[model samples]
Target: MSVKYAKRMDYIKGSAIRELLKLTEQPEIISFAGGLPAPELFPIEEMKEVCVRVLDTDGKAALQYSPTEGYMPLRKIIAERMKKSGVEISPEHILITSGSQQGLDFCGKVFLDEGDTVICESPSYLGALNAFKSYLPKFVEVEMDKDGMKMDELEKALQANPNAKFIYTIPDFQNPSGITMSVERRKKLVELAVKYNVPVVEDNPYGELRFEGERLPAIKHFDTEGMVIFLGTFSKIFSPGLRVGWVAASPEIVRKYVLVKQGADLQSNSMAQREAAAFVQMFDLDAHINKIIEVYRKRRDLMIETMEKEFPEGFTFTYPNGGLFTWVEMPEGVDAAEVLKKALEEKVAFVPGGSFYPNGGNENHCRLNYSCMPEDKIVEGITRLGKVFKKL
Candidate 1:
């Protein structure tokens, strides 16, 4: 006999991208999947030193439950880092969660109600879509060119759906697509949010990893009202394993998050928070992040060069200034999932792009990650995947 689950279970499902990533576990496969940072870049030694110090100095407090809003010291650092993106706020505006991933889920918990609409890029982060789906929100996907989400479609969606909960975006180097919204679009997005009286969720996990040009001011930087809830994480610029991330919003919204965080785990890991705070205080993360940029910039350049020379004429990919992925678009009518099947047989793997679109049907695309693999593996994997594309 099968057990009945909540009706909400009908909306929630396992991530297709994650399910596909399991296949990448094979030792022989060179995976261009999983938006993972280069593990070598993690400040493991520095963190070890920090952890030891924390244990020696304040082991009891470090191990005990902390505040729901996060460690004040860590929040202060996170708030200060916002200056790079042009936002200037205090630690009081921030609420730390286990990771930005948890922040996404809380977004659903705090704001969404079943049958409400969420506006997003035509193809957005698969993980965000999954998180929001748990609350049974319908997605209204707005089309985007290189600049960002098309304004007309977004305005249209907001106008039609009075119950649209939030406008979700990764305005910096976006996931899967690697599209950066233009400054004009960023400002216009704030204008629309103000006009429609809708909140904006600006997720910026990859903003700090800028490899070239000036980093754009985040949408939150332009907020006239407290309608934008900004999500940030140390996963990209530091280590993902630490699971430290934060949300900055108006005091009211931050309080809403704190209430949920109390129920959703009481607080983030106590020892990890203290250790991360100590590490941040003692070391210069900007200098460490520079090291990461130096390595990733080279890897990105190499991957683009290889793909330029190796891929079939019908295939094209993004030349993102920063971020772990490059979006690939195959010739019309080809399904990337099918291309993935053939590539896997040749020992290469990637996430099919169809999974990124919340409202489906862009089967001719896929995302390739260059950060996790070595220079040699990037070359080898792209070459192998190219053969599969060429055959098709």
Candidate 2:
């Protein structure tokens, strides 16, 4: 017997990174595939204390079901944190979700319909692309430069697809490309969004992880007409296992998210919410994030230096100020997937770049993650990848 599946299932495919992770689980494989934070930095000792405190203080509420809007204390903490991004919001306007990935799915649910258009960077986050693809929207890819997505190309796409659902972007240390949008372009993006009357979805998982340079204001900071939806997560800074993230928007927009949340899972994990809140209250989160920044900075530096010395000429990768991954562009006519097969023979793994493009074609690229590997492994992995590229 065959099962009947929704048509959306046909367009949805498993994440390339997720699949690559399975192959790299072997102890000998030096993987540069996943955007994973260093486990050593996780506040396990502090969390053990935090967990005990939560159970001692609010055991009943921690285990009990809560509102779809989320725990008030946690929401207030998130609202306070938004100020760093230059957005002034009240807890009432924020809805906590399982993760920012959930917020991405809710965006597609709220805004997209079959045949609708989505304007995104040429090579955007694979997770976001997959989330939007399930709704069967037509993706209008806009090219990018060093600063970030090309504003002129974005404007052209907005003009062509006047009925676009929303403009999705990762403005800070973007996922695959690791390019940050300039301040000038961030303002211009808001201007264009207002002109087109389209809402902007800003997925910012790495905004606070800056290793150098002054922190840039979020794109939502420039939004005056309440058309920007900011998605924030602790997955990068604090922990991904907790699966805590939030959606900050206008009260009306948040109400829509609240309704959707009720239908999705009724509410997020209450125990996790209390644990996160208690952890922040009991310790210095900023100090903890600084610790993370220090380690990731060294890792990023090592990975970049190794690639510079080892990678063949004609191979190029980004110098990310702060993020998990750097994108490598291979010489023309080379497929990264083919290169990956040879790399795996050397017990090395990475994600090929072609799948990052929703419309597909560019295959001479790959994303290498530095945040997960130690300094020694980073050097070894790059050297192995370098040998693989040189052979081709």
Candidate 3:
């Protein structure tokens, strides 16, 4: 017998970033595609100790079903972390998910409806676009300047789409562009969101990975009316494979997320949660993050240096203070996807920037990840990419 699937399934397209990632597996390819942290930096020995300790102390509890909200201890730690960001939240306002990607999915499920309007920065994170697209929201793009989203355009978009459900922003060291929103812009964004009476989804996975700048207050810090849903993850700071992330929102919104989590997976991995709690308690997470910052900072410098020395004169790139990626904008009329194909032919890979935009358009841009590759490899990869660009 033939089976029929929901019509919504047809609207979903394969993730362009993931498809590009698959092509990067060849040993000859020098990949700058994924936003993965360097695997060498994961504290394997500390994690091993935590794993043994959890099994010895509470193996059964770790393996058994957990409350949909999350492990209480981890939730408490999350609440404490939120306090440092100036967001006053409690364990009651937290819901753990398998990963922050799942948090993105839950956000779409809880807040979005087909044909509802959602605003995102132009050339935003592709993964978020993929997650939200399943629900079929009409994504409105706001132009971004060097400081962050253009306030004038943002105000115009909000006025144009007054029915917008929420504004999603990666305010600190944003993904593809690696541009941090200025403190003034941060305040203005929060003001606009409050003025428009629309909630903001503040995705902040990379905020703590800053290597060379003062930390700014998160948009959630200005959320007096409980209109911002803040998403955080241990993946970047700790182990991504552990798949641990949390959502901090108003108690009322968090309650709905709890019910949604119950239907999605019941709970995040309890063993991972317990081990994460131990990792935070026993090890100096700040020290570990500092080391990561050092590694990535050097790599970022190398990539920037190579690009400057090798790339054509017209090409421009972002100088991010902190974040995994550097965005390169090619000369106008140059297609980034075509450059990507030529670079791949030269055994190098990067995510073409078109995929990052909601409408799949930005032909002159592409994203390169410097965090995962060694300095030498970054030099080699960009050199190869330079050859491709020159040829084009």
Candidate 4:
């Protein structure tokens, strides 16, 4: 029997990173493919305590269905955190999502139409690219410099695509690239977005993971007219298994997201929300996050040092102050996807940079994650990758 699927399903392809993750399931492989937080750093005992408390003290509330807007207490906490970032938002303006991934999906549903133009940093987050692909928007790439997205190029893109639905960005330690947008660039981005009358979707799941850098205000902080939709997540700082994240935006946009959320999953898991709320309120979140930073900082240093020592002479990589990923750019004409196949044979895995770009254009680049694997594994993986580079 022939089976038919929705036309939109054709636009959805299996993630290259996820496919690589499957290859890493073999015990011999050392993976740098996933932008996964260190599981070892998870506050498992603390979470268990919170879960027990939620079940014992508020079983009914935790087990029952929640409002599509999300758990009120969690939303309030997220709003308060945004206030510290200089974005004055309230609980009423926030919607809790299953993860920031879901926030991206909701944003696509609310804002993007098929063929509507959407601008993104060149070699942006693959998760976002995947999320927006479901809506079939025309994606235009804006070049990124070392300091992050080039403001002049951004202005040009905005001018060219005058009706671009939104500009999506990960300003802090951007995924795959691991490049932090400077304060100056951040300000310029806000100005451009305002000047062009285009909304900015700021997906910032990694901002809190900064280990050794001056804090830059989020673009949303400067959005006085609700021109920015901010997405945040506990997955990077707390636990991904919890599946908790939030979106802060204008009341109207949030209202639409709430309606979308109702149609999506009714609401995120109430028990998980209760546990996350309890985890934030009862435990020392800042201290726990600092511990995570300590671990990741050390790992980042190890990976950078190993790359410098082991990678081929022509290989260049981003030296990020804080973030899970470091991007490697091979010499021109060296196909990263081809290298990844060899890397898999060598039992070391990474995501080729092409997957991160809208049109699979970064043939010479790949992204390596330093947060999940141990220091020894990082050294060993890079050493193995070095051999692969030598063969090329």
- Highest TM-score against the true fold, candidate: 2
Badly placed stretches (over 4 Å) of model 3 are: none
Candidate 3: pairs in clash: none
lDDT string for model 3 (1-392, tens) is 98898767877888877887786677777899989889999999998899999999999999998888889999998889877678888788888989999999998999898999999999899889888988989999988988998888988999999779889999988989999998898888889988999889999999988878688888889888888999999999899999999999998899888888888888899999999998999889889999999999999999999999999888999999998999999988999888877887888999889888887677899999999888888999999999888886
The per-model lDDT (C-alpha) reads 0.91, 0.93, 0.89, 0.90
Which 10-residue span in candidate 1 carries the lowest summed lDDT?
16-25
- Residue range with the least summed lDDT across 10 consecutive positions in model 3: 16-25
TM agreement with the true structure for every prediction: 0.98, 0.99, 0.98, 0.98
Q: What's the count of clashing pairs in each model shown?
A: 0, 0, 0, 0
Span of ten consecutive residues with least summed lDDT in model 2: 16-25
Candidate 2 versus truth, CA RMSD in Å, comes to: 0.7
| Clashing pairs for predicted structure model 4, backbone only | none
Model 1 residue pairs with clashes = none
The predictions' CA RMSDs to the true structure, in order, are 1.0, 0.7, 1.2, 1.1
Candidate with the greatest lDDT versus the true structure: 2
Off by over 4 Å in 1: none
Give residue 15's error in model 1 in angstroms: 1.6
Q: For candidate 2, lDDT tens digit of each residue in 1-392?
A: 99999999999998889998887668999999998899999999999999999999999999999999999999999999989988898899999999999999999999999999999998999999999998999999989899999999998999999779899999999989999999999999999999999999999999999999999999999989999999999999999999999999988899999898999999999999999999899999999999999999999999999899999899999999987889999999999999889999999999999999999999999999999998999999899988988898
